[model samples]
Target: MFMRGKCIGCGCCTSRCNADALLYTGEEMDADKVLDEVFKDILFYRKTGGMTLSGGEPLMQYDFSLKLLKGAKEKGVHTAIETSGYYPGKLYEIAKYTDLWLYDVKIFDESEHIKYTGVSNKLIMENLKYLNATGSEIILRCPIIPGINLTDEHFEKIAELSASVSSVKKVQFMPYHPLGTEKMKSLGREQKYENCEFLSRDAILPYLEKIKDKTDKILEIM
Candidate 1:
């Protein structure tokens, strides 16, 4: 489930949930509301052992997340978080309650990350290392933007970083897509990367294979 404020109110979740499990509440949700909704599928989740916490950034609501994770653990549901590692010491606190972490590493270079995401990589990288040190199961997610970070240099840098991290379970290379351009227009913000193109799956395969070939770690395309 996603929190409200940073959400831009995107109805993407409702549109994507084919199971009809997701609905727009049209309101800011507290821990109580989130738990009530999740518990609806407890029987099914207990059988499959699946549950995830994703967001614009989950760590933004630290206490709420802590409660959710604790509750999920008590209910025997596997907990996971999808986040861009920008928060301070929250990683350590959340690690205690979380089962797995989906860490998004946008760009290796600081300036490029700032240009694209309006944030620097300093804190993000630091948080990743901290999570690794804490012995958490972490997956590295990198969005392969054609003009931005899809070059050979960036790929090599990512390989090197991933190789050094012992806690990383897999490295995923995701191709850029224009899926958010229209939303930018609706929100009245200029889409700086609108003209950017998505690389074909064929074109991205070799680069991904090369990165995976460099190390024995699992390489995934997402």
Candidate 2:
């Protein structure tokens, strides 16, 4: 039997059951419907912005993602993806259709990454390297969680990594907030990082200062 609290929302259970017994908690959207919605703001996209595919891991739905991106590109819409880089072998395929990649680089250490996210960083790092080699434009995003990954070493590592990648255009240091705590509660899931204080921009400035000179890419504390 599947235990309630143990579920990590990986969608593996839904795939394993041929009956589709596990209903999705979120609404399903089709590629055509998504493209229609995206095309609605053509002026906005034409002027300064474009569609960005973000997720619960967008690459998890690889076929739909590829189709969506290809459709958007055909319509002359710039495309971007906000990803955790956890997926296997498919990034190269998607890279061809992408304009900008807002890639997340959480904890630099391998063990700490597995401890917090329940996955090793090996795949993530490997994917990043592959993407970098392809000369794809990228923005490295790191969430600054207090007492978690908010450290000088983490910032330095990020800077070092970004510096090594010629295609990296920016490094975004995202401050952690408890904006999803209520959602977790509503889902009847325990809050893993309970009472973790939100890290302010002021708190993150020092780390930014330490790595600012290390990389030529724009460093934004967002």
Candidate 3:
């Protein structure tokens, strides 16, 4: 049997199905229409925010993301991207069109990073270094998840990396919440962090203190 519908290419069906039948129903959007929507908020963007390309991983759709950023830049609008820095080769080209980068650094340890995210940190770290070398403006965003990555060592590593990178403008420590648990379940995926503790600003303060003097970059709990 064959299933025909909008798949979103999330790969949930492929993973859960006992039968090897699911295929990716590629995702697409009209570039002109997307830019039209982005340009509609030009006035508000000028005042505070700007065009930001984020994703399950924006670079996963490298061509579309590149065109989107390019179009935004051509329209004299500021452009930013929130990325996991997983694709170093694609990032180098995308970085050229981006004005600001909201880069995520989950954990510094190689094995632990792979254990939690199911991917190695080698590519992520290499891309970060590439961004730094190219002078791309970046803000490091780290999620402080209790019982997972909320540790003194994590913060210290972040501080050290931030300090070493000349392109990093700020370090944002994001407190993890289980807000997406229901959504994950709805999509036929397991919620690994369902019972995970949520760390408040106060809970993250001790970790922050460990790295306070290590980096001169602005640090904020968000």
Best by the lDDT measure: 2
- The lDDT of each candidate is 0.82, 0.88, 0.85
For each of the candidates, the C-alpha root-mean-square deviation to the true structure, in angstroms, is 6.6, 5.8, 6.0
Mind giving the per-residue lDDT tens digits that candidate 1 earns over 63-96? 8888999888888888889999889765667798
List candidate 1 stretches off by more than 4 Å: 1-25, 47-49
* Tens-place lDDT digits, model 3, residues 92-136: 677889988899999888998888888999999888888887787
Against the true structure, what is each candidate's TM-score?
Answer: 0.84, 0.86, 0.85
lDDT tens readout by residue for model 2, 124-209: 98898889888779999998888888878888899899899888999898999999989898678778777788778999888888
Worst 10 residues of 3 by lDDT: 1-10
How do all the candidates rank in terms of TM-score, highest first?
2, 3, 1
User: Residue 14, candidate 2: how far off, in angstroms?
Assistant: 21
> Order of all candidates by lDDT, from best down to worst?
2, 3, 1
* Candidate 1 TM-score, true structure as reference: 0.84
Superposition error at 206 for model 3 (Å): 1.8
> Which segments of model 3 are wrong by more than 4 Å?
1-28
